[model samples]
Target chain A: MIEIKELIKNYGEVRAVDRISCQIAQGECVGLLGLNGAGKTTLLRILACLLTPTSGTVTVDGHDVVRQPEQVRRLIGYLPEEPPLYLEMRVADFLAFVAGIRGVPRMDTGGRVQQALQRCQLEHMAGERIETLSYGYRKRVGIAQAIVHNPPLVILDEPIAGLDPAQIVEMRELIRALRGEHTLVLSSHILAEISQTCDRLLVLQRGRLVGSGTEEEIAGSSGREFRLEVLLRGQRALVEQALGQVEDIDERQLEQRGPDELLLRVVSSQDVRAQLAAQLVGAGLQLLELRRQRDQLEEVFLKLTGSKEGAS
Target chain B: MREVGLLARREFVAFFRSAQGYVIAALYLAMVGLDFNLRVLGGGAKFSSEVVSGFFFELSGFTMFFSVFISMGLIARERETGTMPLLSTSPLSDAHIVMGKYLGALLFLLLITAATIYMPMLIMVHGKVSAGHLLAGYLGVLLLGGATLAVGTFGSAVTRSQIVAVFVSLGIGTPLVLFWLLGRYADRPLNDVFSYLAIHNLHFSPFRSGKVHLRDIVYYFSVIGFFLFAATRMLESRRWR
Candidate 1:
């Protein structure tokens, strides 16, 4: 439903979106994963026709975002990080207004508004002024407004950013319920949230596309590295010696969590936990806990983005 | 057109729902009432035409001032509150958004202007006044208010701060309001240019006296068109920004 070709958006001296290209198919819930300043919002705004590209082109549903912005706008709904809400308006009135402005036929506006209210679970609060609602309800109203006209694509920028934990779960379910019915593109800095909700991940860093694929595809393509955590009742030097014996070991670090307990981190090309455990037993070191740690998507993200912080 | 209507309705209704709108309307009515008592009624027995003319004169000034306050937040407040993306991303064109906002403010201004009809009606009871004159006077106030609101809309489009929008509008509006003063010092051609350019003196004076000159009507319409078109262009430029 969307295709971007070498899109570049520069704000004076700062290049907010570099020459990046990606395509999103219809009905795919894609997550834009990046830290702060990743240009995710800028890219999404370009797709929504809210911002014109500095160069290249972005098309939605076969319409150029720059040349046929109105057509492109008709095909997509967008919710920015901060929900665009009129506080004094009732939820239903706001949705009806949105529906009307978004080109929903006048005869269908009431039905569309009701469907949106039901979908976002905002029926009970339809008559309540937006200012009287809680933040979570307000965000739901924002989503309701976006989807009121039943656009083919919905772009949400950090939909769960400021929500409480319970709100986040509800929002996640709400977003999940949108899949298959509409092509969804959401941006987030949270790794787990994006991974859990999206069909594919587009990892960006410093205004560039660092990686794009399923989590496993990204991990495998980036060369899977096995990281292991070992708890051993042995001297730190002895644990290091055991790890040194493993031929696949690329790097090893031993930290003493207790007087006689050592927590070891070993990075290797393959799982050598069994071999390391044998070596530890052969060396007369008591192995308390030895398990192969699965390579986390977080590590892959950090490696691709070259960031030390796990969560952006 | 439907989108414009919907947006306009929302904006118009919003004015009544918010305290700032009431405050602006109340302050405007109070000023008009005070001016009516102090200037029109207080100064001994004046001719009914003069009283109505004086009312329009005071109204024109207040319309200019209050129109700025009413329009300063039209676009700027949307941006400040992060509601601009809703309109910007909608299928509606930039012209539609600008026109809708303009119409909403114009409607509210007209309502406020209409509320002052009692003052003119009072003149009818105490003295004889032509209905045609009253009609012409109200039409003039509407035109002036429309033009001022358009200028203020342009001002709102240029900034994101309501305070800045007010100053920017005043900056653009003050010169036109002061053109009559400039006309006094200039000679011949320059004086004529200043006189013609003056927003109120030559253009609005005729309407104040119950005379509708075609040239004056055209000037007000021209001001309205030029500023509204400017506001539309300002809105469209946001895509690039």
Candidate 2:
């Protein structure tokens, strides 16, 4: 339900967000993938109406962000990188306060707060002061406040940035659960970190929209040729000898995995898994596994950004 | 308007929820008490009316000082701790946020002012003081305190550092309160303007003397309104910046 056209935001001499544009359909879970300084936060802030675009138009539904900010604000729930929490306030009270400010009707504020509490699984800590909670719980509270008003669009900037592995898994589940209820937009520096949680990805590099689509689509758009990996039970010579007959095998690597098992990586012009599997079994070799390379996207992402993996 | 009240109540209650409130209260009461014992009530056999008036006159200075302390964190701390986005992204206008914050700090200032009533009652215990004198003096202190708090809010709005906010507010308010002195040495129309702009002497004196003038009332409110409006504009400017 959001449309942005050629959005640009400048911080004086620094162009934080360049002329970039994208649309977020209703109930679409979109991840803004980028490394540090990729303008993810700046772009999200523009969509959240916390910052006005330097040029071009951004509208939520039919309301322009600059001209009709209050209406735009009413339609959004934004969670900044740092959880906007008042440490002295209790969990439920903080959510209630957020609900009030977010324009939830006073009569329904209690119920709304409780619903948000339950959504974030913070009902048990409802009465606890914010200062007494751990960082993970605080992030949950941040999410709770964002959903308290039940806005149509929920913008979470770096939602999983500071979480431990277990917390990240829980947060992933939490974000996944929110997909059908609202249009979700979150940012992360890693490609695989949020790819599984989002329906589509908007890859940014140095203030530009470099790539946008699903994982396979992004991988395909990256112009990567066909590739596959296979595991087999045989001597290297016999495996290589069997695969030497395949005409489409442009390049291949055969590495010994165990005494009898061998690992084979193949790059080819066409599908050769069926032919390769038959060749292995025909040569009196046991075929253990054959599939597409799983980490191709990671390589594609690194190639696109031209930066080392996990640089940010 | 309803949002203003809700936000104000939240901020007002926040003061007592932490140790900051009690520390400010304790320090303020002690400072005012020490000044009252040594300066207003200790010196000589002054008339009860003069003593109460002098108490208010001295109390106004402390009120302004403490008002700066109270309001320094109103918005600055929010920005420092990353909570400003919650307010900035909300449907509430900047004016509403500023008013909510101003009213909250004002309520706390008034509460602290209320706590100082014991000092006045101490005057009442032995000396004969008119209730009108006491009330009018208190009205002046509250207005002066509130006006300074608005200045502090403006200061807080412009910067993210509370220390800078305190200094900026003091830097702003010190000159306004000292305008009467500037008027004393300056010439012509400038003198009249400077004297009128004086926040304390020219405006607050009447209220301290148990007489409420519409002009002084207008002046205090104008200061409050002008600064609060400036603060709201500062807050709104953030979206563009």
Candidate 3:
């Protein structure tokens, strides 16, 4: 378990992390969602013991980060934005070295390295020097080094930041495979990556945690109406009449596509897509198409982080 | 201790795998060899003891210069390549990381210094030279190298650029080297203090002449200890930044 209480970190006159507090239960995979200067890196660095907090306390599994950093470090594996790798070493040798320094038993170092190699699917690149590998391969090597010691918690920052679409998918699967074995804390600015991979999301804005919960929970907390785009093959007056009958529909806008086709934008306090479709069909209208608008998570994130761009 | 050993081993292997280490070693050996051939051998009618003493004198100067090159990249390169976070976030203390890097650089220094043995052995073959003088001279070179390397390690810890690290070390080391010249113009106790603090003039002269004073050994070791402690403290202070 990880417990952070009113943690604060300052750089000169600027407060990078301001009085943030949270608790992560065992075996939970959480994503930290934020913008560029949202204090995500600073918070992770403090948890990793790379930087000391200016105030408050962070404890990992009963060990205080400031007072017993080494003990805390022993329990967690951290992969920074840029992977901390030695390019001169071969992949296998590098994993072995990390395992050794991370306190893997001498007799089991080779076995542990082999397991990491397999876990990261770098078994074929084991003999290759890290400098010769491509960026995607290097990221795999970074993940391999982090988990070589079988740490209880693994913290990854921007794990899929620069990968291609295919690589991102592969990386997502790999992260998902690490779910049961270790508690994970991953940070990213990409909303879909966080929504797809993480069980819960902690949103930050300008150095403060703005909100945290599951996708639905966060959307519910935002108190925003659910939006749907309805395409109907009927009269606009009948569509408006059907929308008025629905109790949850707060607002509706109609755009005439043609003589028989109309587009309706419906906002409701709850998910009323099924009810809206049934009402339109029952009111002597043909439902041509009905689709929910963009993901509510994006809306919740943008509103929370105060960004105009939806997601990238 | 085991963590220190592991870090040291990694750094030691890194030195051999990188081009900078080989280039530095090769250039140092070539320059030292050229000096030995031109000055020690080319000068005519020199006694074997004088040749040995001159050899130590020239080698100590080269050791000081090359130690700066060897140690300048110790921590600075890690920062440049973004690998320092691995060590900082590990379960090891700052002291262990500094000590391990120092030991690894010192070991490489020892290897290069030991390779210069044939120069002294050549003198032993052609002329009469005392084994005691040979032992004393190598000890002086190694100790001086250790001190200069510690200064360079501190320099590396203070900055991220290897070039800046070298300049920082030279900035700190050049003053001590010139302290002997400064002592000549000073008066009374000031002159005495400068003479005592001089890195080469008063401190290393005895070892060059086949005399191993306990005070000189203590001075070199104290220098090594002081700079290494400073390097460790610099590393610790970076967490605040």
Per-residue lDDT of candidate 2, residues B134-211 (tens digit)? 899999999999999999999999999999999999999999999999899999999999999999998899888899
Once model 1 is optimally superposed onto the true structure by TM-score, how far is the C-alpha of residue A101 displaced, in angstroms? 0.4
As for TM-score, the candidate ahead, 2 or 3, is 2
Off by over 4 Å in 1: A226-295, A307-312
Q: What are the lDDT figures for the candidates, one per model?
A: 0.90, 0.90, 0.90
Model 3 stretches astray by more than 4 angstroms:
A229-247, A251-266, A272-292, A307-312
TM (chain A) per model: 0.79, 0.87, 0.86
Query: Could you give candidate 3's per-residue lDDT for residues A1-312 as a string of tens digits?
Result: 999999999999998888899999999999999989899999999999889999999999999998998999899888998899999999999998888888888899999999999999999999999999988889999989889999999999999989999999999999999998999999999987888899999988877888889877777877767889988898878987898778877888999888779999988889898888889999989898898766766777878666422331
Top DockQ model:
2
Q: Model 2: residues >4 Å from true position, as ranges?
A: A232-250, A268-294, A307-312
User: Model 2: per-residue lDDT, tens digit, A236-274?
Assistant: 788877987777888988888878788899997666878
lDDT for A121 in candidate 2 is 94
Q: Candidate 2, which CAPRI tier?
A: medium
* Winner of 1 and 2 under TM-score: 2
DockQ of each: 0.74, 0.78, 0.71
Ranking by DockQ: 2, 1, 3
